[model samples]
Target chain A: MEAQTIVQPEKKKSNQDVIIIKHLNKSFGSNKVLVDFNINLEKDENLVVMGKSGSGKSVLIKCIIGLLEPDSGTIEIFGRNIPDLDRNELDEIRAKVGFLFQGNALYDSMTVRQNLEFPLRRHWMNVNQPEVNKLVQEALDDVGLKHTINMMPAELSGGMRKRIALARTLILKPEIILYDEPTTGLDPGTAKEIIELIVAIQKKYRSSSLIISHDMNCVRLAADRVVMLIDGRCYAEGTYDSLKKSGDPKIKDLIE
Target chain B: MALPVKTTDFLQETGGISVFTGRFFKEAFKPRYEISEFLRQCFVIGYRSLPLIGLTGFIMGLVLTMQLRPSLIEYGVESQLPAMVGIAIVREIGPVITALIFAGKIGSSIGAELGSMKVTEQIDAMEVSGTNPFKYLVVTRVAASTLMLPILVMISDAISLFGSYIGVNINGITSFPLFYTQVFNNLGFSDVLPAFVKSFFFGFAVGIISCYKGFYSNKGTEGVGQSANSSVVISSITIFVIDLIAVQITNVLNLN
Candidate 1:
């Protein structure tokens, strides 16, 4: 079945753009992952980057978070160029940015409470034990898994582990959150719950989020704007409804 | 000009390890020492390996004494058993054996651990949380192993001497004080210092190489296994090479 065609509206520019990338290029030897990819995430907006497996969605997110360096171009986060920042400066930028891994990379050796407390202890070195405990409790409470505080990550189920990882990310109260395939491996029901939680958390925290996912449901439910990454570039971008009505075969391929 | 694939891979691996070691040195001395984490690693990498190191040391001492008794009896030097065993264990055998055992237990463990973290993006998550994963994970572990191996060697030497005493009593009687006196009398500063110094290098080789392999590991679960396996192999070989160099250096210095 062919979807009806529609013109996507021009995106309104905002002075509150929290993250801006321009002509970014990243390659692993001869394999170019991101080529001249450009995107901007505005304040308190949920921007989803959708791409197929091996299409560099993770790499893009990694580059933004300083996990992977770009071959060229600028990643301007909060008026600072990421590649140009020194170690200490980069760390300062990172403190304000939270990331959720597809695998829920909770430290296997740490208890849930410890996991939540890691960032707080690291970034807020002067925070007292009582404050640390309270922050840990609050973060876990945000994820609705306060009961799992003392349990090691191994003891938690897959969904619970994801919640704990999210809680850890939340504990920092970061200004920006980058989610790499947030719902990649969960069952449909669990995936829906996570999506809902992400939406709720975004609303509560009002933090800008750059989410990388190929999950259409995740894009539909969680994305305020969606960028389609293809051929190592920003293939297309629009609201989910606008893109769903796009006649471009590439856009149709993803929406369907 | 193109190098053979294997040659290129070997060159890449070597270069990567060297760079990683250099980075460890750089990050290690920087501010924000992970003292508590380093202590935890010391307990894990040093204290936890005790039973295995102890068992092996005991067996090595007992077996060495028994083996030397037959050979020494022919030369009528059987009474010098304690001194010979002591010198052998303290000067060369103790450090090398404990290090090899450490490589087996700790090297593979660090490699698998960091490999899994890389794959799961926990390491990335740490960076996004404003923590230097290298400082937090690598520096702490490498520093712990480097500092702890010498201590482990010392304890292993003591245990081996005790085992040697038991071996001495198996055939004939020797008072504990006399046996220890004979052992200590034969041991000089040269024997102890050189042996002690080399253990740090051994630990460093294991820690740095394993971390290098795991930190850059790819290909998911298989990569984790490969990282673990390669860590042990490379660390064992490096230990022998280092021992050879230490022996040569000691000889040059006339420490023998």
Candidate 2:
């Protein structure tokens, strides 16, 4: 008989939705830090979160990164729920995400080169020294700080430190970058430079970015979509122009 | 007024203690080694504490020798005084007293630094960068303490013996060589080893606990003071507790 069994090809799933957070809640004793928080990020999108200082913007990002657990919520990243993952699994997820901390959080003791080299060495052991050097150089170049690669964090200016931190974040070529107050203490000019760098890097790398900032200028310059957090929930989210035109008092206050 | 004040103080103390312990363990194994930061901590913990440890050890030996002189003269066994005091200092007093001083200086500083970092979101920053702040900050610190404290104790013990020699000469005509011989002859491996081993735990406890207090500190400026205070208190108490347990275990083992 010439009859043969039919064969079917398996379809590859799309990772177009990078992050999905739903009904996230967190509390400390009687104080609720995050409540009914929900956010979704598409692949290669730049989302800026803006809020008052204590309005839980940082807390929300921390929860997504698995640094702090939610009281009740689901955080799905790359089609995997974080809370259910074991330590190794969580670590594996974390390796694909980069974070640029507000204070530039560079290791005070290590040279900038070592700081950039550290994560690469840890996660990609098969990477040789020349490859690491080339990658570090590329990252530094992207931040316009290639010359600072050999300097210690203590030796750099605040702006240099921030750039170095950015370089460190870029070293791993992460699929997602989360920035916690990237321009908080910088001078206005330096802040603008950093914001531009953030936008440029995100565009170049095609990585999804979630930037948490109180600075309106940063939100304006870097955000493709702005999510205004207030009272532990997302009060408004749209393009920056739409947020400005919404006439919502809280959004007005944040923009003005 | 006193009731509220007392309650507040108790809460402050308890909160500080809990935060310190929590952070230390949390960050102990995270990666991105801060070698310079670790060295700076060592300098503060090991190098700076040396003067205080040395002075305290010296006084302890001298005072013990002076106090024992009258009793020794009564028994016509004044020559045995050096050995007794030497054993006492190296076996128990040296490590304990040095650790207490270490607790005061190194423990408090670590607690305060880490606490301030926690307050300012530095540790949080470390986490975002894909660096394990625990391994870099806590493990290196604990390791430094474990390694350096024993060396510091050894130096302190030596200085104390010299001080005892000086104290003995103040009353009687005992040469340096004679005093040295007497001290060594009386000290068996049992006396030295147990004391030496105890200090590693002492160092570990001081480092781990102080870091624990500091790393978890919250509540802005208030958390800083809490970190310093709790580090000192817990490390001091733990030194004694560990010492007691070590002694009991050593005695049991030696008995067989």
Task: Give the alpha carbon lDDT tens digit for every residue of A128-235 in model 1.
Answer: 999999888888889899888889988988889888889888888999998989888899999999999999999999898999999999999998888888889888
Interface RMSD of each: 1.3, 2.8
Q: Show where candidate 1 strays beyond 4 Å.
A: A1-15, B1-8
Per-residue CA lDDT of model 1 for B45-123, tens digit only, reads: 9999999999999999999998899999999999899999999999989999999999999999999999999997788
| DockQ, candidate 2, vs. native dimer | 0.34
Q: Which runs of model 2 end up more than 4 angstroms from their true locations?
A: A1-15, B1-77, B128-136, B143-151, B170-172, B188-197, B240-256
Residue range A1-256, candidate 2, lDDT tens digits: 1111122112212348799988888988998878787877878888888889988887888888888888998999998988787756777888888888766777665799998987787677689989998999999999998888788888999998999999888999999999999998999999999999998998899899999999989988988777778778877777777777766677789888
The sequence of per-residue lDDT tens digits that candidate 2 reaches over residues B50-79 is 888889888988998999999999999988
Error of 2 at B115 (Å): 2.3
- The candidate maximizing DockQ is 1
DockQ of each: 0.75, 0.34
Pairs that collide in candidate 2 are A109-B36, B20-B212, B20-B213, B21-B212, B24-B212, B27-B134, B30-B135, B31-B132
